[model samples]
Target: MSALERLNGTRLTGTEEAFALHRRINRTATDYPRDSSVPALFAASAARHPDALAVVQDGRAYTYARLDRLSNGLARRMLAQGFTPGSTAGVCLTRSPELIVALLAVLKCGGVYVPFDAGWPDERLRGLLARADCRWVLTDRPEQLARRLGACRVLPVDEGVEECETAPGVEVGGDALAYVNFTSGSTGSPKGVAIRHRSIARLVLGARFARLEADSRLLQLAPVTFDAATFEIWGALLNGGTCVLYPEGLVRLSRLGRVIDDHRVTVVFLTTALFNAVIDEAPGALDGTETVLMGGELHSIPHVAAALRRYGPGRLVHVYGPTEATTFATYHRIDRLIPDSGLLPIGTPIQNTRLYVTDGTTLCEPGRTGEICLAGDGLSPGYLGMPELTAERFVDREIDGVGERLYRTGDHGTLLPDGSLVFQGREDDQVKINGFRIELGEVAHHLDRHPAVRRSHVTVSTERGERSLVAFVVADPSVTSASLRHHLRTLLPAYLVPARIHLCEALPLTATGKVDGRALLAAHDTHTPPPAAPAAQPVATRD
Candidate 1:
C-alpha cells in the first residue's frame, strides 16, 4: 500500500471495491525540490524568464526583469535600514505593481510582511501594526501613514528606484516566519495569523489546485490584504506566470468579463458570492478561462450547473479553507451536474494536508456531522502575540498513531458515502428559533432552489421581546414574500420557514464580499412587518 493510501485509512486489496475507493480519496502532494522561500523561488523564476511579462495593471505592464530589479533594490535598502531576519515590517499601499514589489521585497529581505489595507480606518490600522510590532513600514505614500504610525520607520518604495546590488543572502530555514495576516474576529479585535516559509512554499510552489504554469495568466481579483491574494500573487510569481491585477474597488461582473477576455487570463479566483453573481448575471463571463477557484461561503452549484453541462472551457473548482490553513486545504472540481439536493461536497484534503471530522473526542463516521479539523505542514504557527487565544483555536489531537496539532475550523461538515465532505454551516449558525434548531445553510439552500430566487440570507432577530427568523433574498422585482414563504413551506417544516421575508435588488456584501447577514438583520429591524398572504399564513404562537 502507498503512503497516501495508508494515511487515508485505505488498505490495498485485489478487488474493484479497493480500486474505486483509491480513486475516490486521492490527491497527489506536490514535491518541492528547490528553494522553500517564496521570494527566492520567485527570483529563480525571474532568472529563467527575465523579459517575460510579470504583471499588468491599468494598461501598463512590468516584465520579470523589471520586477526583479525593483524588488532587489528595495530589499537592499531595507537590509541597510536594519530590516533583517526575524524582523516584521508593515506593507501599507494601494493595489498596484508597487504593492507587489513591496511585498516581495520584504520577503526577499528576510522580514515578515504584515500587509495593511489602505482602505481601513487609521485606528484599526494603528492597532494592528502595534500588535504585530512591525519594525518598519513600506508604502508608496509615506506622508499619509507617517502620522498614524508614530516612531515606526516609514520607507517609500520609490526611493532607490535604480537597480542596486541584491540583498546579501541569509540562511532562511523552512520554519522561519514569513507573513502575518489579521482575520476579521468575531470579538471585534482581529487576530493575526502567523505563517512560515514552509507553509507558503507548500501552497505556492507547483500547487495542483491553481493549475498555474510558466505560460499561465492569472488575474489578481482579491484585495491585497486578503489571504486569497497570496495564492494569486505567488502562484504566478513562483511559476513564471503573469499576474494581472485589477483596479482598486469591488469588481463587477461586466468588468470581470472584459478583463479576463482582454488579458486572456488562464486562471482566476473569486469569492463564492461573486461567482454566484456572475453566473446569475452573465453566465458566459468565464467562457475562455482555463480554471476558476472559488470558496469562502456555501457554493451555489445549481446556478453553475448549466456551465458544467455545456462543457465550457473553464474548470470550476470549489476550494475550502480557513485563514489558519494557508488559503486552500481542500478542493472539489465540478465536472458534472450536482445532485438534486443542490449541495456540493467540500472534497478531500490538499497536498501535505490531513483532515478529521471529530465530535470533540472521537472521529465521526460517514454521513455524521462534526467539527472539521485540519493538520499538516500548511497549518499556521499560531495567532500572533495572543498565546491564549492561539492555544484555544490551535490544539493537539491524537490521530491514527501519532499526536499532531490541528486547527479547529469551527465549521460543521459530514463525510459523504464516497469519502467526500459536505459543509454544514458554521457552529454558531445553528440557531434555536422557538425551541426548534435550524441550520441556516440548509434553509438558504432550499430557498435558492426557487426559480426566481437568486440568493438568500437568513438571520435571527428579536424585536419587541419576540425572537423570529428573517430572510433577505435577491430575486426578480415582481417576486413577492408570499411566493417565497409558500415555496419554502414545500421543502422545510413549518418552524423552519422564515417568519419574515424581504426582497432586495442585490444582497449586501462585506468588505471581503461574503454575504453580510448583520447588515440585512439591521435593515429588517427598522421596517414594519408585512401582512401574511392568505395561503401562507403562519401558525398561531404565543410570545
Candidate 2:
C-alpha cells in the first residue's frame, strides 16, 4: 500500500506506491519570507549598508544611500502624477542606469512595472502596452514613442526630477503585484505574467544557486526586459551587493571581457545561445568571473564541456526556469563533466521551490518522463487579466493530503534517481530561440494573415546545434520569401521573423487535415539548396 492509501481507506496499486516514493524524492521544503515586498527588502539592505556601492554603469557609481535617495525622489514625482499602488506602468528604456532607476522608482511608488524592449517595433510595443492596459509610460529615450501612446502619461527619468530625498510612505504587501513579464503567446499576442513581490524576493534573497553576497559584483548583461534581469538586478541590490551594468548596443566579446575585469564581477548569467558563442569565439571572456550561469534553451554539450575545461567545473552552473517562476527555479552546479555525458541535468530545486515530474494526474516514478511541474514561493500568481489561461496552466492538486498550486511548465523531463531532472523537450509547438520563448503557432498566425498568403506553417530547423525558424507558406506565385520576411519584420520582432521562408503550392497535411510538421521538414530536407558559408551573428543583442 502507498502513503496515500495508508492515510485513508483507499487501496493503492503499484504505480501509486511508486508515485508516493517519487514525491518524497523530489520534494524540497525550505523557508523563505512569505510577506515581503521588493522595495521593503531593498530599503532594509540600504539601511544596513548605506555606504556600499549599489550600482555602476557608464563610469558612474551610485552608493546605496544615493540610489535610495534618487529612486525616492522619482517615486514621489510619480505619486504626484496620480500613479497609485497596484497600477501598472510601461517602462520603455534601453539598459542603463536610468532604466534601473525607473524600475526601482515604480516599485517604490507601489506600482507594477511592465518592461518593454526599447528596440522593439513601434506596433509590437504598442500592442503589449494595450494588452497590459498601461496608462503611463516611463522612458529615457525617444519621448516621441511615449507621447504617441494616446492617453498615457510619459515620465522621463533622465531629465532629473524633484529632489525630494524622501521615500514614499505607501504600504505594499507580499501578495501585491510587482511586475508583468510578457512572453510569446500562441494566439498572435503576448501573455503578460503578473508576478508578485514575494515571488521575486524568493529568487534573490538567500538564493543558493549563485553567490549573492555583499562582496559579490554581478554583471548585468541581459536586457532589462528579459527575465534574467530579475536575477541580475535584485540579486545584487537586495543582497547588499553591486550591480555592474553593461553598456547599450550589441554585446561584443572583447568589451564583455573588459567589463568583467574592470568591475571585478563575480557572477554572470548568459543564455545558452550566447554562452555557446562566447565559448567558441572568446573562451577567456568569463575566466575572471566566479560563477557563470547559462540557461533559456537546451544547452549544447560541447559548449558545456568547453566552458568546464576553460573555467573549471566549480565555476560553471546550469540553471532552468520559466518567466512564471521568477528568474530561476533550479541550478545545477557542474562539479565535473563525464565524457559522453549526453546532456547535463537541470539539477535540484532552488531555495523555497518544488519540482515534480507528473503525467497530468500523479507524480511519475524515477526515470520516467512527464511534464515538469513547479510549485512554491518562486511561482507567479498567474497571467495578467487572463483568468481562463491562468486556470488551465496553473492548477491546484493534492498529494499526500496537502493541496498546493503547481504551474505545469509544458516542458517534458525525466527525474533521475538522485532527484535531478533531465530535460526531454517541450510538449507543444513553443520553442526557445536564442533564449526568447516563441510560439510557432504565433508565427504561422501572422504569416497566414498576409493578403497574398493562403495558409502557412512554421517550424524550427536546427543546424549544428543552432536553431532558426523556418516557414512553409502556400501563397501567390509572385510572393517571394524576401517580401514575406519584410511583412513579418513590420509586425514582429526580428527574432520572431523566420530566417528562411519557402513558397509551396500547398502545405503538407495529415489525415486529420492538420499541418504535418514532420512531413514539411522532410520535404525541405530532401530538396533544400546547398548550405552557404555561415556568417557571424550578433550574440548579445536580442535581435
Candidate 3:
C-alpha cells in the first residue's frame, strides 16, 4: 500500500513525517463541547471577563462590559424601531469595535445583519440593498444611508438609538439566519450567501475557548463587509480578547504592525498577501505579538520558512475555509513548511467540522482525489434568497436514514496519507485547455512551489476563439515571467503552460482578501509595455 493508504481520518503521512512535526493544533483533546447558540457564547464571555478589553483602535479600547452595554443599547434601539423578527437590517460600516457592537445588536433584536460595504461602488451597494430587500440600515446617520437606499429604513447605530420594545421580540434560535454575505458574481451582480447562527457558533465556539485576558490585543484588519471580519470580532470579544481596529483605507496593514507592537498587541490574523508584506517590510518587530492567523489565499511555504529563520516558528497559524463555511473551519499549525512535503495541508478540521473528499456520489478512499465536502455545524444555510443556488450547493443525502446537508466546498483535494487535507482549489477552477482539464490551482500550486515566485494567480483569458492561459505572479527578486513560465513547462504539458506570464508587483485581492482573479483579468493588458524593467532588488512591499 502507498504511504497515504495507511492513514484513517487524520493520521500523519510518511511524506509529512519526512518534514517538520505539527504541534497540538486539533482541539479534540480539550473536550470543549460545541454550543448551539452564538449570542449565549458572547454573553457568557462578557459575563466571565467583563473588565477585559474587547476592542481597540487608535488608542481607543473597549472592554467586554462596555461591549455588552453598547450592543445591548443598540439592540434595544433596533428593537425600538420596527425591526421585527427576521427584519433585514443592513450595516454599511467599516471594521471597528462599533461595527461588531452594531452587528451583535442587530442579531439581538431578532433580526439579521445583512453586511453592506460602505466602500462598494454606489451602483453595487445599491444593487445589494435592493436585492436583500433591506428595510433599514444601522449607521451613524440613517438619513444619508436612507437616501441612497431609497425607501428602506435607516437606523443610526452611532448616535441615539431608539428604545427597546416593552414586549420581548422574536426568539431566534440555532437555525435562524444570522447574516448575509455577498460574493462577486461573474455576471457583475453579486450573489448573497445566507449564514445561520449555528454555523457561526460552530466555527467560533467549538474551538478551545481560551480566556482572553485583560491585555490580549487582537488587531481588526479586515473590513466588516468581509466574513472573516466576523471571526476577528467574535473570536476576540467572545474570548474577552481585545480586538483592535484599523481605520478603513488603502494602507498596507503590515505598516501598522509596529504601532500594534507599540501598544503591546497580542494577536492578529492576516490574509497571505498582507502577512508576506509584514515579512518583507519588518519581520522581527512582530515577534512579541501573539498568534498571527493567515489564510484566505495561498501562502508560500519558503517565504514562511525564511520568516521562521528570521523570527521564530509557531508565530504563524495557517487557517482555511470559505465564507460559505464560516470565516475559517480548518487550520494547520505550522512550525515550518518544507518543500519535500509537497502541497501544504490545510491541516485538520476544527472541533466539530468533519471533512470528506467525494466524487459527487461516492466518498473517495484515502489518496484518491475528490471534491471537498464539509459536514459540520459550521456549514451555512447556503446562498441567501437564492434557493436554487442554495439547493444546488448544499447537498442533502440520507446516511443510514438520517438526512444531513453537506456543503460542497467547490474545492477539490486528495486525502493526505497523514489524514490532513491537501487543498486543490475549486473544482470549477479545473478547466479544459487544449482538451485537457487542468486545475488552475494545480498550475498555481507549481508556481507557488517555485523558489522564485512569491505568490501567483493562474487564469485563462479569451482571445478571439481561443482561451489563452495567463499567469499573474508576484515573485522573489530573482524570478522573471519568462523564468517562471519556463519552470511550469518542465512540469506541465505544453498546452497547459501559461503562454503569457505577467510578473506582477502583487496579486489583486477582493475586499475579503481572497485573490481576485476577475479583477486581475480586468486589469491585465497584454499590449502594455513591460514594467520599466524593475531593478533586481527588493521592491517596496505590495498591498
Candidate 4:
C-alpha cells in the first residue's frame, strides 16, 4: 500500500490500549526532579560525546568539549560580575553558535535566560527586557540591540575570550527555572512562559518520537526566541547529537536545501507555515533530510500530501503542542495522507505530560472537542508576575486519583477514537461580532486553503462600537479583494467571512516566521479602510 494509504487507514503500531504506551516510556521520574538543572543534562551529553560536534553555525562547528570549556569560562565570568543563582539574563542576538554558548553559560551559572526576539521593534524589545528584570544582555555588538537592552551589562561575543572549565563537578538540584520565553497573547499583550529544568528533560525523554544517536544532526530552523528553537537546541545537545543552526537567509527553499545538503542534516523541524512553503515551492530541495518534524500552527496539509507523494511517508512526522506544554506534547507519525482535507491527527501525548480534554473539570470522552489541560513537569510556572491571569488559566486538578496542577491551554481539541488528537482553534481566539463569536483562525484557515492563496491572516477590529473583519492574504497575483471575499462567503457563513480582503505578496512574520498578526492588524487604520489589494507588502521579511 502507498504510505498515504497506511497513514489514512491503518491502526498505529502496537495495540489500541488506553493507558498511552508512548507516555509510559517517556515519563519516568528520577530520585530528584529532572528539570531542576538543565546544565547537568548538558554535562551528561558532553561527557558521553565530549569530542562530538555540538553546535554548527555560520559554517563553524563547536564540539561538546569546546562547549563545556566555553560554558565554564562564561559561567565564572558571570559569577565574578556579582551574578547569583536564579538570576535572569537577556539573550538578544540572531541565531548563532555564540548564542548557544551564552545560553549554556547562563544555565551553568545557575541563572535563567530570557531569549528576546531580536527582530522585535525597539519598543517591544525594551518592554520585554524590562519585564524580564534582566541583569545583562548578550549581543553581537553595540548597535540597536545593545541600546535596546538598556542598562544591562552587554557582552560582545566577537571579542576573543578564554574558555572556562567546571570545578571537577558542580552540583545543583532539579527544581530551578530554565528559561522564560515571551510569546504573543490574544489581548494585544505578551506573556512569558516559564519552563523548568525538569520539564525540559521530561519533554525530550517523554517522547521517543525520534531515533537518538550521537551522529544525528538536528536542523535548527526556529529563531532563538521561540520555544521550537529551544527544543531544537537542547533536544540535540542533551542527546549526544549535534545541532545544525541554519544561518539567516538559509531559511528560504533553495537556500534551506543548500544548508541541508552542506551539513547533512539528519533531522529537520519546521513550523507548519515553513513546511508548506517548502513543499509548495521547492519539494525537490529536501534531498538529504531523513525526517521532517513539524508543529506551531497546523499546515494547509494538502502541502504535506504533496511532500509525501514526492518524498515517502517516512519523511513527515506531525508534532503538536503549545509553549504552555514545553516544546510539544503530541506526536503523529504520518504514514500516509487522507483524501479529504488531509488533516493529520496529532497522535498520543509525550512522556511525563498528561493531556486532558475536559468540558469543565471533568475529563472529556473520545471524539469530543473540549479545552485541553496539560499536567506534568512540562507545565510552565504560569505567566510571569500575572497571578490573577495565572490562577485563571493554570488550575489544580486530579486525574487518575493523583493530584497535580494542569495548565489550561486555552486551545480546543478533541481526542479521536484512535487516541490521536485533532486541534480546533483557540478558545479565546474567537472575536465577538453582533453578539456572535467568530473564529479568526477559521477564517484564515479557509482563506489559505484556497488554491491561489499562499498565506492569510484574519483580525477583527472595533471602531465606534462596531466590529469589522479584515483579512490579509497572499494569493495568485491576479486575485483581487472582491474575488477572495466572494470565495470566502461560499466557504464560511456570512458573519464568519471577512468584510475586507486585502491581498499582499506576503504577510509579515515574527522573528520566528509565525505570522505577525499584530503587524497585519496595524495596517488597518481607523481613518480609512485599506484596499482589499494592499499595494505595499509587509514591512519586514523574517528569516
Candidate 5:
C-alpha cells in the first residue's frame, strides 16, 4: 500500500477510531476563499467596524477608520513616488501604530514589505537592505537612515503627513508577493523567505489555534521582523479584533500577568522557553489569557501538564512551523487528561497544509521515524535571490501518482500509531534559543572569520532546563572572548551570538581527523548549572 493509504487506514489503531481521527485532522482544510488577500480582507473589516478600536499602545488608540485613512494616505504617497506592484520597500521603525500603518501602506501600494529591526546593528541592517535590493525605506527618522544608507530614499512616516480619505487605486491579488522575512541560513548569511498573499490569507481565514474573532483581543507581542508577527498583526485586523501592542523593554513576568488581566486579552503566543519559565517562576501567570499559543522548540511536557492541571489543555495550543512555511503549518490542542511523561503529539496539519514523513524515497508508516516534509498553500515561493539554494531545499516528488512539491524541513520526527507526529531533534547543526532559530554553521563561520581565530565549533548545552550556545575555539594567544564577540556583533545578529566561548589549546579530534563535537562538549570548562530562572526577560518589543 502507498504511504497515504497506510496513513488513511486504521491498522495501527482501531479501524473506526483511526478513520474518525483522520476526519478530524482534515476538518479545518475547508471553505477557504482563493481570491481574498490580506489587505483586501482587512479593508472589508474596516468598512464594517469603522468606529471600533483597531489598535492600542501606550494609552493611545486608533479606530479602524483612522488607521485606514493613515495607511491610505501613505499608500497614495508611495504610488506617487513611482512605487509599483513588483517594487520592494523597507520599513524601519519602532513598535508603534506607525509600524502597522507602514505595513498596510506598502501592501496597498502593491509593493512587497520587508521589515527591519531598528535595534539591529547598522551593519547588519544595511546588509539586509542590500541583499533584499530595497532602495526605499519608510521611517520616522528619515534623515538618519538616508545618510546611513547612501543612494536610498527615506520617507518620513508621521501624523503630520497629509491624510487620504480615499483608497489607493491599485490591484493586489492573492498570488502576489507580500513580504520577505530573513532567517538564519547555513551559509553564515541570513536568507530571506518570500511569502505570498494567499499563504497568509489561508492561515488567518479559519485559524482555530488563536481563535481570533470580531470581538477577540490579542496582544501584539512578536517583533515585526519575525514571521510570528504576521499572525499577531493581520490575524486581528482581518478578523475585526482589537490588537493591543505590548510596551518595549524586557518583559517582567509579574507585569505581563497584570497586562493580561488589565487589557482583557483573549489570545497570546509565548515562546516555549518563556512558557516553561513562567510555569516555574510564576505559576498561574497566564491564567487570564483564554488561549495561549507556544512555538519555537518543543515544550516540557511536565510543565505543560502542570498548566493543564491548573488550567486546561484546551487553552494551550502547540503551534509548529518554520519561516519557510509562513508562520504555522500544524497545531495541536494538547489533551489535558493525558500524563505529562515522554513526548506529546504535534497534532495534524492546519488548514490547506499537509504533513508527510519520509525516509528519503518513500513515506514511513506509523511508529517509524523519518524526515518531516511539508506541502500545501502556506509554503513560501522560496528564498529570495538564491535560486540554487531554493531549488536544493524545495523539490517535487511523486506521491500516490500525484506530483507534489515539498519543502525538506531538515527536522526528523516519527508518526505515532495514533497518527500524530512526535518531533525529533534537527538532523543538522541548528538549535532554537528562546524561539530564535540559530545555525551553528553560521555562528562558526563568523567566528572563524576573525583574525585571531584558528578554528571554531559551536554546540548547544542544556543545563537546568535551559538551552544555550557554547562555542569551542582554538585561537591565537591574544584572542579573547570579548574580542571575538565584539567582532561577531558587527557581522551577525545579536540572537546568533554564542553564550559561552571556551578557549581551548585544541579541539578534540577523532581518528578520522574531524573535530569531535561530542568530546569537546563533554570536556567544556563549566560543569556548574545556570540559574534556575530564565536568562532573558520575556518583554515584547514594539518595533
Candidate 6:
C-alpha cells in the first residue's frame, strides 16, 4: 500500500510522520497583547506617535493625535446618546477620512460596527441593518437614508459633529465583538460574521506575511464593508502607519497608479482579478509599492509570473483566507517562478494561526485532497444570529489529542509535504467575482422569486480568463432576458447580478434528475455565441 493509504492504518516513518504532523497543523506560536481592544491599541499608538500621519485622502491628512481627538469627540457623543457596549451600529458612508473616524469612534464607544456600502441599494441596506439588529446608522446622507430606514436612528459623520474631544470612559475587552461583516449566503440572506478585537489584533500585529511599520504607508482601496479593510485600516492605525484612502467609486487603473506613486505606498492588497488587470493594463502601477498582496480567487500563473518579473521576487505575495478568518491566514511569497503544476501554493499559516487539511473526521496526509480548515486566534467567534450554522461550520475536533475549534472552509486544497497548501477550488457553488463572494443558490433563490419565472439555475461562466455569473431560466414566453435582468438588479447587488441571463423553454437535467449545470453550459456553448451584451436568449434543450 502507498504511504498515504497506510497513513491511517499503521505507524509511519519519521519523514512520513513529520509530513503528517505538518499537514495536520501548521502554526507559529506568536504572542500578542490579548487583553487590549482594537481601540485601546490605537489609543496606545496615538499616545506614542501623537504627530505621526495616521490617515490621508486627496491632500487631506490627519495626524495620530488629531484623528484620536476626532474619534474621541464622536465616541463621547455616542455614549451620551445611550449607545453602549454591545450595541450594533451601521456605518454607511462613502470612502473618506470621516469613515475611518466613524469606525474608530464606534469601537471606542464599545459598539459593534456593521459597515454598509453607500453604493448598495437602500432596500438591501435596510434589510441587512434590520437583520444585524442595528439601532443606529452613521452616514454621510443621514437625512435621506433615515427617511427610508424609519426604524433606525441616523447620525451624520461626514459634515462633522461638534462635541468634546475627550475620550470615552468605557473600557472594552479583547473578546468584545468589534465588527460584523456580511457575506453571501445560500439561504437568500446574507450572514454576518462576528469578529472580535483579538481576532483583528492577531491578523495585523506582528504579521509576518507583509511589512507593517511606522514608516509604512498602506493604501486603503477596498470597500469598508469588505473584510479586507480590516487589514488595510487597522494594519496601519494599530501599527502607527499611514492609511491613504483611495478616492471613492470605481477604481480606475491609471488613477490607482497615480495614487500609489503620490503616496509612496509601501503596502497594497488587491483582488486577484484587479491584480491581473493591473498586470495586463498597467504594470507600472506597482513600481513604487514595496509589497503587493493579492488573493480572493485562484490566481493566473502568467499574471503571477509577469508581476514577479516586473516587481521581482519577494515583493509580490499570494494570500488566502475567508472573511471568517479575519482577513488573511496563510501567505505565500513567490520567490521564484511557479512550477509546472501552474498552481500557486497558498503558503503556510501566519503567526498565531493554524491550518489543517482534513476529510471530515481525520486529517488528510500530504498529497491528499481535503477541506481547508482554519483555527487559532484569527478565527471569528461565529456567525451573528446563526447558532446552528455556527455550530455546523465551527466544530471542535481533536487533533493530536488536543481539542480545538476549527472553521471548515469549504475550499478544497491539498497539503504539500513542506506544509504549504495549494488551492484546488471550492467544494460548493460559491464563486468569487472581482473579489466579492457570491452564492449561486442565493442568486437563483431571488431569480425564482420573479413572477414570470418557473425555475432558474445560476452558474459561473469563464470566457477569456474572466469569470461572470450566468443565469439559465425556464420562464414565460412573454418574458425577455432584459426584464429578468432588470428584476434581479433591483434585488441583488451589482456583483451578484448575473452578467448574462439565458431564457429557455426547459433546463437540461442529468439522468438522476438533477439540474445538469455542465450539460446546460455545454449546450449553450454549442448553440450560443459569445455574449456581447448583458443578456442572452437561447433555445435550451434537456439532455
lDDT for 381 in candidate 5 is 91
Q: For every model shown, what is its TM-score relative to the native structure? A: 0.75, 0.92, 0.72, 0.75, 0.91, 0.92
Tens digit of per-residue lDDT, candidate 4, span 1-543: 643443342222222233353234225343434634778878888998899999997668889998889878877877787888878988866677888888888888788899865544455566666777776876766476666666777876643546876622445566678899876544434577888888787766434567646778888877666677777887788788989988872356777877888888888877665666677677766768888887666456667777877888777888877777888877888888667755578777765666777777455566667887777778888888778889998876544434557777777887776667788767466544432334576677767768888887788765532356788888888888788876765544454566677777788889997788778777755447643421110111223
Worst ten-residue run, lDDT, model 5?
534-543
- Candidate 2 vs candidate 5: the TM-score winner is 2
Ranking by TM-score: 6, 2, 5, 1, 4, 3
Off by over 4 Å in 3: 1-36, 141-143, 159-170, 206-215, 253-255, 398-403, 429-543
Candidate ordering by lDDT (highest first): 6, 2, 5, 1, 4, 3
**Model 2 stretches with alpha carbons more than 4 Å out:** 1-27, 509-543
lDDT per residue for candidate 1 within 237-312, as digits (tens), equals: 8899999988645566667778889999999787665665566677667887898887766566665685576545
Model 6: residue 231 alpha-carbon error in angstroms: 0.5
Residue 196, model 5: lDDT of 93
Candidate closer to the true structure by lDDT (higher is better), 1 or 5: 5
- Candidates 1 and 5 compared: the better one by TM-score is 5
How far residue 224's Cα lies from its native spot in candidate 1, in Å, is 1.4
- The residue pairs that clash in candidate 5, if any, are 95-542, 95-543, 251-539
lDDT to native, each model: 0.74, 0.83, 0.65, 0.70, 0.80, 0.84
lDDT of 5: 0.80
Mind sharing the TM-score for model 6? 0.92
Give the per-residue lDDT of model 6 (tens digit) for 260-335. 9999999999988888888988889889999999998878999998898888888999999999999999999998
- Model 6, residue 310: displacement in angstroms? 0.9
